[model samples]
Target: WSSSLGGVRLINAYGPTETVITATCYDVPRDETLPDRFRGVPIGTANANRLLYVLDRHLNPLPPGLPGELCIGGENLAMGYHKRPDEEKKVFVPDPFRPQGRLYRTGDKVRMHGNGLIEFLGRVDQQVKIRGFRIEPGEVENILAGHPHLETALVAVKTDAHGEKQLVGYFRPRAGSRPEISEIRAFMQKQLPPYMIPAAFIELDTIPLLPGGKVNRRALPVPEDLRGQLSAEYVAPRTETEEELAAIVSSVLRIEKVGVYDNFFELGGHSMLGTQVMSQIQEKFGVEVPLRVLFENPTVDGIAAAITEALTQSIDEEELAGLLGDVTDLNDDDLNALLNDE
Candidate 1:
């Protein structure tokens, strides 16, 4: 029977001459519904006197949901491989708990998903961490697949020169139609939290498949190399006074000298930072800009010009002072006196 279509907990045993008659067996359940591309569980007992321990980097047993590497220990553990003692030494580690014994470090990363179920995450080498958060690309891809319009999606992490990591997603449309970037962004917004969402989305006609008939994530195209990849890039600053406003944004945002061609949120800016940028722009430019300015200009140069324009068209000093004074007096506690045409 074919591997994927089979409805049996099949176990095939094979091994090399030195490894002895294969003592390991992988269990594939009948009609196992492994979501996405997750494989089935492993089926191997502690051969007589062996031990299996799943541990984190700190050698402590991880909680059920937390992922960790699997270590195998016991008398059944193999001896040194040929004259490659150094290579053997790296794979075989001395167990801290068990005295006078070593364990083979299987590079597999897995999570105990409870109820006697252990879920394989991926290889430890493939795990990518960002901002002190351990992330599995498969988990993000699975979340994206939950969207109604998205037929399939794959997620990967891109690292810049400064060692900063960002998530990028590649997806195929359900039908023979092209989906707008805005629509995909909005759809992801509803399904995932901000950190989990892809910083950039790339739509494709089909996901590349490997020779083994699995999604070839490594072959996915990279995100476009847009100069200003943020929301601040689209708007252009219009006035000279706005030019000065751009300086303040460049200082606070710490970006590479922003211009009208840049974008605010696309430069990895957030709502809180937007408020600070706006406040500084208002103070330095002597103008009160709206919170919507960030969404409108989204770039230092653009926001500066917006402030300058708003200032130029604003009311004169006398009218402004009168308005302020009226507001101040209106707050006084003589309600009846004030209401009686005071």
Candidate 2:
């Protein structure tokens, strides 16, 4: 409200150097609409005698509410930059709908929300399809930056041994602050949709930068281990129960090398996932770990110890004969579900 003390109001505007200056404007004249937040703030409707287009890959116009590359056109458009004809040719493509006219591809993905107001999603190049989900790395980065101890975040894709694409996140903590991978993951799991959550996180002293001060993405190191979450220290599973729990957790969570000390809840476990874990533990070990046990013993070491203690008391070998029937090739989840039912 301190900003309103001055008679002059602030206006949100958008344009590129190619447009010389502002070409679009957004004004929130109402006091009630004083503050507005955008995923990436929408550059409002076009300015006087300006044209904007949200188009598909083929340069065909897209319907409202659909995200596509933004194209700019109008009399306000400037000619090609000096000694930059090659770069200009790439963006200044021929507009099919407008005879002999050209449109500047902005490389920005945006959607029309309501009326003619367009909301910026992210850069078109930043959008990647993961498991059929169109993921904006900036969206994931935004969630990571929301972490209490984080100073900044970056999300990018990497392929593993089999050439499967995976989302990996890199982060830097605030000065003199240390945060665990589980803590950051828990924060992200709560904030972002599951598909958008990075499968792995890597902490960095600093994000690699190019000579021009842009991110040198090509320089990001490929993690050899490919663990779901990278920890500063390596702790292995000790007991057989711990090992099984580690394997099950890693498989179920799509993470790699879960240690005995890792907390399930911190590793993106919710109530539904807790139920599956309980059932799987029951089937695999032929032991019934009550659902409440998960909350009490959330860590691998604690949960494995509790499972061992339970098996020691309820060693019903005769009942196990029938319950363990034909489990030769059953998957972990199915086997656990079957055993839990018995």
Candidate 3:
């Protein structure tokens, strides 16, 4: 029951009382892990007399790697919620395996990994599938908040008249800062999987808070006119580095005539492809730069300037060394070698 502080990973757990403290527990590791960020470790295995089944809406067992509602059955099932038959009906249902025994409808959507460990994807209510891919908004929001300049982030999915889902991100800049939209999108590109990246970003002064002081997600303003404000007509890059940056954007965005002021992510670039563009740029220019810098200046012109500035700094160091005699203090080995050469 310990509270989490900075650098602490929070793992919220749930299990019915009849199952004893908890029949199962999940351990979410600190930020970075090998394969995926959302994958968690199971604290215990299914013991005898108890059964855990992940099922679809039809109560049929789901195949592995697929997400479905979790149903808990066996001897540890609760008698039923007291004094409320309707409430009891909501959670307690007849088990398919036992034929007559009640099963607890946990309402949690989970996917069983190969090792028998379940990956919790949030409640069925919050679970959303976009573009035929299941998406957990909380997972995307968590990745965005890890950025140094991002104070807060919120992910929302809206369906169009055609019922096509579109992911949107709302964020507030940290104190003493206003970062470029390109930068944030680029940062997200590295942190999330392809489908998890938001389609658009909206800057907010503050996220509406509910009566309980939690995020008032329902009250979030729609992004109908927000796009026109964040990005106006494209601004062309002014420097040689900006030209190079524009080239990268042109390739990824498929727009030959991109302005230096145009945002990379705004023009169809996402986190997954953003990494590709970054890798290409690094290989082309031979410089190691921070991912956070993209958030600071997300346009081609901005990236070019950053690259040019870095290159200039390197050149300045070399020029300074040449101007001031040899940079080396002249170790005995070097001095003797120099004398021998003379």
RMSD of 1: 7.9
- The predicted structure with the larger lDDT, 2 or 3, is 2
lDDT, candidate 1, 75-140, per-residue tens:
676786889989887778898778998877776676665543555556677667665556677767
Model 2 C-alpha lDDT per residue in residues 1-342, reported as the tens digit of each score: 436565566567977777657867877453544223344445788898778898998998888888898788878777876899999988888877788777888887777765888876668888788666778887677667657688877778887555656687888899988998778877886777666777678888978999999888778766555444633245798777788888887776666677776666545454567788888888799888887777787778888889888876776765676566757668999889987999
Residue 113 error, candidate 2, Å: 3.3
Which ten-residue region of model 1 has the weakest summed lDDT?
A: 12-21
Considering lDDT, where higher is better, how would the candidates rank from best to worst? 2, 3, 1
Off by over 4 Å in 1: 1-50, 80-90, 127-138, 145-152, 159-165, 173-192, 206-219, 225-342
lDDT, each prediction: 0.64, 0.75, 0.71
In candidate 1, residue 158 scores what lDDT?
Answer: 78
- Provide the TM-score for each candidate, comma-separated: 0.55, 0.56, 0.50
Q: Distance (Å) between predicted and true CA of 295, model 1?
A: 12
lDDT of 3 by residue, 31-144 (tens): 545356333444334555668888988899998879888788888877876799998887788888786787888887777767787666667767687766778786676677
